[model samples]
Every structure is written in structure tokens, then in C-alpha cells.
Target: MERKCNNLPFLLLMQTSKVIHNQIKEEMAKNKLGITEFSV
Candidate 1:
């Protein structure tokens, strides 16, 4: 239904954010950057 369709993007965004966040963390650790810098 319409509700289920709307939920798809939200779920996708959450999944994508998790992946990006982890990737950023890895990159920050590799270069020794702070959480604030990685967030920005």
C-alpha cells in the first residue's frame, strides 16, 4: 500500500547511512581524524 511504499525510502536511507558512517569511521581512523571532523 501507500504506507509500505513510503517506508521503503526511510529504510533505504537508514541502511545507506549506516554504511556511510562506518566508511567514514574507517577513513578517519586511517588518517587519525576526530569524530567532529568526520561528522562534518
Candidate 2:
């Protein structure tokens, strides 16, 4: 139980970042931007 609890937040953070990453990719695609262009 202790190990599972410790990993819970890490898993949640990864999932949240995945969602945000997908959103950014979609936005970049809509704007016809490359990764480097989007980062600026």
C-alpha cells in the first residue's frame, strides 16, 4: 500500500502531462507550426 500510494502522484502527473502535450500538438497542427516554432 505504501508503494502504491507513493507512485500515485507520479502516475497522475504523467497522465496530466500527456493530456497537455496532446492539446499542444493539436493547437500546433491547427496553426501549421513546427515544434520549434511552437516553442518560441
Candidate 3:
């Protein structure tokens, strides 16, 4: 018997993460802030 892996959730999570990262990057750029500084 073989087990199948489900990739949809992981792919969706990565996609969502990338979108959020880009949005944060853009916002930080607009504010002239570093990621570490922004996080603090």
C-alpha cells in the first residue's frame, strides 16, 4: 500500500505567506523602516 501526500494546504500557505511578505515589504519601504525595526 502506498500513501499519498496532500500538497494543496502547503502550497496555499506558501502563497499566502508570500503575499503577506510582499505587502509588508511595500509598507516598510513606504515607511522607510527595516523589518527588524518594524517588528519591534
Candidate 4:
């Protein structure tokens, strides 16, 4: 239980980042921009 609690924040952060990343990808696609282009 202690170990799982310690890792919970990291796991949540990863999941949140993934969600944000997918949203960014979708927005970029709608704008007809590739990931490389969008990053710049």
C-alpha cells in the first residue's frame, strides 16, 4: 500500500500527459499541421 501510494502521482501525471498529447495531436491534424511543424 505504501509503495502504490508513492507511485500514484507519477502514474496520474503520465495519464494526464497522454491525454493532453492526444488532444494536441488532434488539434494539429485539424489545422493540417504535422507534429514536426507544430513543435516549431
Candidate 5:
């Protein structure tokens, strides 16, 4: 039980990190799309 409790925060942090990375990727993709559209 104690081990599980200790790991909870680590798991949460990993999930949050993944979410942030995904958001950055999405934003970058959107920027690229905008640039492509502008060029065309």
C-alpha cells in the first residue's frame, strides 16, 4: 500500500508531462498548417 502511494505522484507527473508534450505538438502542427496556407 505504501509503495502504491509513493508511485501515485510519479504516475501523475508522467501523465501531466505527456499531456503538455501533446499540446506543444498540436500547437506546432497548427502553426505549420497556417504557414503552409499562407504560402499557398
Candidate 6:
């Protein structure tokens, strides 16, 4: 339990980073779709 507690912050940071990255990827994909539609 002590070891897990020590690593809790790092684990939370990684999880938050993954969430932000995924959101950014989704937004980029949406913008790309708009660009493609405009070109067509």
C-alpha cells in the first residue's frame, strides 16, 4: 500500500495526459474532415 500511494501522482498524470492527447487527436480529425469537405 505504501508503494502504491507513492506512485499515485505519476499514475494520475499519465492518465490525464492520455485523455488530453485523445481529445486533441479527435479535434484534429474533425478539422481535417472539414477541410476535405471544403476541397470537394
- On lDDT, the leading prediction is 3
Give the worst 10-residue stretch by lDDT in candidate 4: 1-10
- By the lDDT metric, which is better: model 3 or model 4? 3
lDDT score, candidate 3, position 13: 96
lDDT of model number 5: 0.76
Which sections of candidate 6 miss by over 4 Å?
Answer: 1-6, 33-40
- Give a tens-digit lDDT track for model 2, residues 1-40: 3544468888999999999999999999999999899879
Estimate every model's Cα lDDT from 0 to 1: 0.87, 0.90, 0.92, 0.89, 0.76, 0.76
Residue 30 in candidate 1, Cα distance off native in Å: 0.4
Candidate 3 local lDDT, 1-40, one digit each (tens): 9966589898789889999999999999999999789999
Q: In candidate 1, which residue pairs get closer than 3 Å at backbone N, Cα or C atoms, i.e. clash? A: none
Model 4 residue 40 CA deviation in Å: 2.5
What's the TM-score of each model vs. the native?
0.66, 0.77, 0.74, 0.72, 0.64, 0.65
Question: Which residue pairs show collisions in model 6?
Answer: none
For model 1, how does the per-residue alpha-carbon lDDT over 1-40 read when each residue is reduced to its tens digit? Answer: 3545568888999999999989988899999989888667
Off by over 4 Å in 5: 1-6, 33-40
Q: lDDT of model 4 at residue 32?
A: 100
Worst 10 residues of 5 by lDDT: 31-40
lDDT of 2 at 6: 62
What is the Å distance of residue 14 in model 5 from its true position?
0.1
Q: Give the TM-score of candidate 6.
A: 0.65
lDDT of 4 at 1: 38
Question: Model 2 — which ten-residue stretch has the worst lDDT?
Answer: 1-10
Off by over 4 Å in 4: 1-6
Per-residue CA lDDT of model 5 for 1-40, tens digit only, reads 3544468888999999999978867876878765456457
